[model samples]
Target chain A: MASSISTVPHRAGLGHRLWQSRIDYLFLVPGMVIFGLFILYPLFASQWFSLLNWSGFDANQAFVGFANYAELLQDKYFWDAFARSFIFTLSTVPAQMAVSLVFAIILNNKLLRMSALFRTLIFLPVVTPVAIIGIVMTIMLSPFNGPVNIGLLDAGLINRAIDFLGDPNLVLWTLAGIFVWKWVGVTMVYWLAALQTVPAELYEAAKLDGVKGWQVTFFIVLPMITPFAIVIALISAIGALNVFPLIQSMTQGGPYFASEVMEVYIFRNAFATLNGAVPRLGYASAAGVFFGLAIMVLTILQIFAVRYLRSREKPNGA
Target chain B: MALEAASSAASEYVIRQPLITPRVRRWIVSALLAAVCCIWIYPLVWMVSASFKTNAAIFASEGLIPSQPVFDNYLRAWNEANIGAYFFNTLFVTVGSVLLVTIATAMMGYVLGRRKFLGRGFIFGLLVFTMFVPQGYTIIPVFELLSMLGLGQSLWGVMLATTGGSFVIFVLLFAGYFSQMPDELEEAAKMDGVGFVRTFWYVMLPLSKPIIVTVIVMQTLYAWNDFLLPLVVTLANPAIRTLSVGVYAFKGENFVDWGGMTAASTITIVPVVVLFLFLQRYFIDGLAGAVKG
Candidate 1:
């Protein structure tokens, strides 16, 4: 996109000496100061601690060289969490991408009335806090007298009530389904916004070539919106990594750690104070640093992969 | 592909397409979509309906609308539950964080967007890098840092913990507006010995409204609904709990109150929902900004 639009900036600055220019960046101090104090500082500070053996307090801390990272590597729970998070990202992202894409196509049909109202309703769950979502899902999916189970029972769908969150065997997939429902609409909004930008003329041309319906969707619409698709995928990936509150409220990583993602595992060990003491700050910090690095690597790889694939495409070739 | 599908569908239909006209098809699709939409929204409707019902009526009225909608649940949520106090606390914290994020990110964004300073590219990359840093990965250090800074177990700690948000800084990459903005008004103001601060206040601030509004809306929503921050840092102090935290407080160790929970949840979300209804246009526009990679 940048290469395609490269040239002169429409809002030209005077090409005078850099020092002599009137564009003084000194005006940006107050905001920078806040970001520096709160955000930028904490990250580097965390990295510095990742190399130390401090239990989150400075008084009796020791600078243990890579001991935290070494311990993290050997920790069984850490690897379990990493694997669960990968499974979560795998199960949720592609399903959400597919459903959200269908929603976008339906909304963009132009002839549909009440689409705006439907879009707004679909987007309601996006702004609802994850904590509440957890409570609502837990109650609704409860085995006895909960509306969901009752509806299924009345329909003769099941002989006995199912523990959606309590059964370890069926828990992760159940959580995945709820996660998809909550976010699929959010992703649909992104898709709808991106879809509007795809010009109508391309569709008419495709129709003239005897292309319509699913053929037009696959051949014409999909390729045109690949850039937007890549963006939504990255957003979904980042979102899955932070799936904390919903799990914490509903299950608390119960059913023998079957659904524990990295976020919850870190919180449980680092902040919960559940076993009658302060959470393991140093070890948890190491886990956090490890996960952060992994995310950074994944994001960079995704960007590179998308760019290379996009470049390999011969304009519109399949 | 077209021939395969078209021929199959045509041969499969036994009535030879003697059935529905386009008008009937349109109405049928609309009605079907409406039913699905209802199914989609049933959870939300059920929640609201349950919130208005008495304890027995909630379980009894499960099949349809509440038989006799009562206001006691809402009253209990408002007064006894203290959701009102939590709402105020949440609004204050969220507004404070959003202001801090916007002012800080905008100033930094401006410098990175408009200035040719030292390590400009490095700073820009660093800011972008922060976007991928999740709380799951940052909370351990953050919990330590907040306590070390004497802000833990307080509302202020919650405010400070969200400072590194990258959503604000990313807005700076689209500095086309700054490069495009006419300097005549600022030049005239500066010619009168108006310093950078005064010039920014009287001139530059007015012009950066679009992006500023976007930052405000996005940050406000995040701060309003944020649970993990308050949950982690302010657990010891119920007084410091935000609306999100207050809603979770209704969950007891022995049992959960579904009616009270939904009542609290409804109360908690009303403010954000009201804000969304009011700023529907600006909210979408702000969200569109986040969508731009």
Candidate 2:
């Protein structure tokens, strides 16, 4: 991709400079080729597709510029799915951060024995495939014979079994809860990494000062890690958009499309034949581009946040 | 010395404390952690145990131990459900993609990290910028492009698409690792009349074992667990479905085959679990390094 840029050196012509550095450029070829083919090209292709009215089934495509985006504005389903994506991010990211933060604190405690065992156990779910998690969670939360419901009933928590994934009202929150459980380990790791940044001398000083443990955590530790929490939250929010497999495996954005987020909505329009809906390739691309832009903005903010955090960490800036 | 003195003094005080003494506190923390662990691992434990249970017994009780264990599910999943094929397919795609990524990123990292080159900053900045762009709906174009090249229905297509990302982090990882190498290493190689490629191949690459292992472990987990691209690429060809896509399809077809589903799920998950157990340190540090990088 950068091959187009012709850099003129003070003592050598562009061609001469290129020949001199041919090996370096040769080394970049394989990766750049793959990147251009799979990533860079498709980005532009998706945008171009968003301008056409083409069913994915055929070659007949009518150029309908921005009509899809206009339609997306009035489309209640599109808006609902878009809103749900944000809702999923909002619902899960904080909960994930909070729970993981507490666990990270517990695991970070020096006095805690067998913390590595506990850490490994908590992290076990992070590596499990999301599709498999969806399948297992479906069974475990099955209303009829699921262990979760059975345990609840056995403990007299409720009069009857609740269809966790079947109820449209309850499904999103249920998926959110499972999402947290599956990914909390990752955020916990991030927190642990961040926690490790705090100098041990600070803790020793706090202990020598007779400060209570909880006070030390709330005062010194929390404030010190606040900057890292921002970056962690951003990463988690970006990850929250990647629930396509989980939703696809467990619910397929069903129970009346209640669990449908933007990704699922785009996927359903682009590929799925469910609900007798035709594959609106162009519109799905438009939705994709739109969501992609939103995520890009979040990502940019995160980059800046990280830069700021780094600057703050190293007072003598690089 | 001061640090040790401070910690030892603190421990002495902790041991003398009343009510919630250090020992009692340790037990309380342990109990709490143990409870959480049981909850966390219950589903995985349940799935593994259920694989051995008969279909009737799976629904009869959600017990961790099967009253009547059976090996039929494994045989059926392996023979009937096509998991055995999908496993190999996943292995092939993962290995191929990892090899591609490792080579490409390592080369890129070495060049950009060790040399001053034209467009280096521009190219590096471009890669970083693209990382933030969510790859929404690009799968359609990728699928179409693969088919256009007449490779869409093949596992090779899946491998290409899987590897066809910015991979900015891995590149940065390699770059950062290589950047920290001593200048003398390169000077020594140059003095011996070794050319750039040979020097990298013989000296630089060998020294980057930790980074390479980190990249391989991370990419293996990604390629093994990746679902969406494999689903799209192999949509027209069930014969080439990877483990993740295959497991989902198998579950869809055999909705009530709980025993078979459990067995297939276990087969899909075991390799990853075992890999993580083995390379747990690399996995954790890799994540931290990526974020830090």
Candidate 3:
């Protein structure tokens, strides 16, 4: 049916063809307007905002040519936040992918009954609000009387309650663990979908070859789902870098800026005053532009990397 | 008779040998996964249980079941935090944004998917590229844009802001669905002398139920759970705050009211969880399609 429709001649002129498809243009109008205004415009407009010295409240703003960028280059707090953000991303993405892959592999087993129930239970956190998760975790991980501390003491793992969110050394890792807990379900689902696409014949053939379970998983399953693995990694990395409300609700980047990440840093500078520091809208905009461009570059690199990997694999009959 | 019985037992042993290992292994794995699932959902279960417990019980007991359940937390959370007002506000924004996004993206998706129009690829590419851009970085400008348009501090502004942020996801889902749809129905409508808009409104729109549901479910969760946008845009007006922002404020104001706070948090997550439970399949499929797209 599609072939027949495509084979029909379009003998009309270009202008006439466009005119005939006026309804299509009309269909696109509203989405385009909103997308252009809210999303696309912000991509460039934020860069413009980054160049100015404005408090985000005053009307008279100084036209500082690259001054914010210059200041951003020398700012230690900005770089510290950036490093912390990278750490959060690095820690969570791998942990999430690893745990989720295991879950996906187990759940993919044909003989696993009540799989639906397990999947729903695991995914419950994903649907819950991040702020709420943060709040709950804050309570659950409280140093003195939190359930986690109580459980640890009861289990004889520790004699004293450790301040999970209070200690500078432990805050970031705790936050990363919490992030993995919430988001592993999402990555697991992605892996499950990817796992289903792997041919049954391959697994059967491997079994016929006397391949062990771990070997089959590592050699056949892992390589087969590499594309999805890479995509999941990139998505999680990007998401982790943008962690905000979780930090806000839980720590507010407290304990001497130990848990501070790029988004929270930007939020602090742009809107809220934290620890007696004044709001720096211009500096935050500059930092935002920097991080935004960094993400764009990372995405482009990922696209290239994926294409390159696919190209390399195609010769081997991928 | 002894020899015959021995042979039958030997045969049964061989058959069981081949099957017993994997069946046992499968059960072990299922049991392990069930344990992991409990750990994963423990926080949420704990939260719900704690919402019912008295403050003393919440701190003292680490168990799932409450020793003595009380309804006071919910009452205080509802009254003190003005949760009812915030719930209504969240519902209003979520519904408005979901409806607007569904219609707008459906129309856009139809064009981009089914038609070979000028600049379609370019516009689609632009939209896809915007997906990678960190939206958190742009909140300041978005806040300014909303204020400039005089929609700031209003639920309508929050709705509109949320609409375009993830607009690409719905568009991709809808476009993928529409592209795969058979063209014969639309062609038949054309043969009957129906106009293009009529064909879309009557034929294509009606046929887009699945994709529409996916979009609605996904967007509803997003708009309902969203915090940062509403946080920034509704800063001036406390009356227009959504559940998330209101709950955050509740925490800030009553720093020690963990009971009430947990109660409010429970209230905030219930609607999304209920909707997800009802539309579980669509939610999973939509998420898969979104990531793949």
lDDT of 1 by residue, A162-206 (tens): 888889988888888888888887688678667655555565555
Encode model 2's per-residue lDDT on B1-293: one tens digit a residue.
46434543443343333457778887887898899899889999999999999998988884688877899999999999999999999999999999999999999999888887778898888777666555455787888898889888999999988886436668888998898888888888889999989999999999988788888887887788788889877878999999989889988899899899999999998998899889888677766655554
The prediction achieving the highest DockQ against the true structure is 2
The residue-by-residue lDDT of candidate 3 on A1-318, one tens digit each, is 345335435676778767766778888889988888888888888888888888876574677989999988898988999889878888889999999888877776644668778888888998898889988898889986888888899999999999999999999999999988988888888887787666666665666676666677788778888878777887677667657878888898988999989888888888887666656677788899898888788788878888888888787754
> What does the TM-score come to for chain B in model 1?
0.80
Q: Provide per-model DockQ scores.
A: 0.32, 0.47, 0.36
Q: What is the C-alpha lDDT of each candidate?
A: 0.71, 0.84, 0.82
* lDDT, candidate 1, at A179: 87
Task: Give per-residue CA lDDT, model 1, range B35-118, as digits (tens).
Answer: 877888678788888888887777664555777778888887878778889888887888888877776666666555555643
Q: After superposition, how far is residue B269 of candidate 1 from its true place, in Å?
A: 0.8
Q: Which model, 1 or 3, shows the larger DockQ? A: 3
How would you class the docking of model 1?
A: acceptable
Worst 10 residues of 3 chain B by lDDT: B7-16
Best-fitting candidate, scored by lDDT: 2
Clashing residue pairs in candidate 2 are none
User: How much does each candidate deviate at the interface, measured as C-alpha RMSD after superposition?
Assistant: 7.5, 4.4, 8.0
